[model samples]
Target: MARIKPQALLNQSKKKKGPSRISISTIVVCNLVVAVVVLSLVTTYRHWSQRSRNTLETQSQSHRFEDTNAASEQKSYDLPGYADINTSKGLITVELFKDASPEAVDRFLDLCQKDHFKGMPFHRVIKNYLVQAGHSQSSIPVEEWTSKGKLRGRLNTSPKHEAFMLGTPKTKGNNNKDFELLITTAPIPDLNDQLIVFGRVLKGEDVVQEIEEVDTDEHYQPKSQIGIISVILKREL
Candidate 1:
């Protein structure tokens, strides 16, 4: 071969170096592109996973809502019936728990059906606490007894004064045997066994509290007689 000049040889070396540099740059660019693709895939996967989890959670919440609504509907359908006792002081509405306490509810319903609560004074009133009422002595025997003669005969048949006493039971343990109403606030002793709470005052708690606040005599009877004008039961919800 003919001898090449040093400058020509240097130029040839530079030309070779340029291709190597271009190759290295190309390799670097390819590696960077692959890294970016991998990063993009990872980000997409993470986002999709998060979205799926959120969607599942939302679906679960929707199911729970449906279940809760169904339960509420069932409860509304099954709720016990209520009665309104229109008192001189105010109105008292009670939801009868016949399933929880049958005898108690039956006795109360019997009296209410008879309209026995007309013009009966609340016998005992305790401030912020309770009231005991339903006495045969409030009105004349004729007026005291409800128009329905069924309960009158039952009560009149009893020789004992306690038997006819409203809220007082002939039997010692059963409070509901008679119409002896006890205003319930604090926990009463032996209440579950000794007495059955047949009714609850839904609206006249303020009236009960007012009655309770009034002064009582030595017998704990309210100074002012809080009378119940009438107590009626409505079957409609």
Candidate 2:
């Protein structure tokens, strides 16, 4: 057997190992590109997930705030079995003494529910005395309210001097009058049994005071025309 030369032996080894298919530098570059792509995808996914979570949180907070405000409004302004009178000045809430003046209260509430008092001015306003309203026939001159019998025949009539004492039986008589209610600013003992005290102010007395302070004409009509805008009735809970 002939001895193989060194150069020939090296050539043979190179052939057996096959041709140089990939270089070290090429492998390193490919690995770096793959790593960069993976990093970019992870970063984009994280950013998108974070943005989605933030949007959901913001929407949830907004819904919660709206719900809280709605609940607050319901609790603040809605009391069952009370009358809320919307006037030009502001809201006035009154609690009717139904037990004492059942007929009178019922009549007044019925008129309110029917919107009969809307746009009716306080026909008679006496300073430091009482504020009287519910005159539906306010278009005519104040002097003609009674003489024309405008407010005389429309409401339930209770006998004059009907007793409205808490424990006493309701008085028997024709006392019901139409669209004429009084809110006394001061104590008027003489009016206790004489007039039907159907309801008293529970809130917004300041608005009533403002009404009383309005300038009035010689006939006790509000010069600026203070009127009832609307009336809402809530049942007592």
Provide TM-scores for the models. Answer: 0.48, 0.49
lDDT of 1 by residue, 1-237 (tens): 999999999999989888533578888999999999999999999999999999999999999999999997776455446777677777766666555555666777777677766777777654433466767322222222223443423433221121111223234444433556656543333222334454455565666666567788865577776778887776564
Worst 10 residues of 1 by lDDT: 157-166
Worst 10 residues of 2 by lDDT: 160-169
Off by over 4 Å in 1: 1-80, 136-177
- For each candidate, C-alpha RMSD in Å? 14.4, 15.7
Q: lDDT of each structure?
A: 0.59, 0.66
Query: Which stretches of candidate 2 lie above 4 Å from their native place?
Result: 1-80, 136-177
Number of the predicted model whose TM-score against the real structure is largest: 2
The alpha-carbon lDDT assigned to residue 17 of candidate 2 equals: 96
Error of 2 at 10 (Å): 99
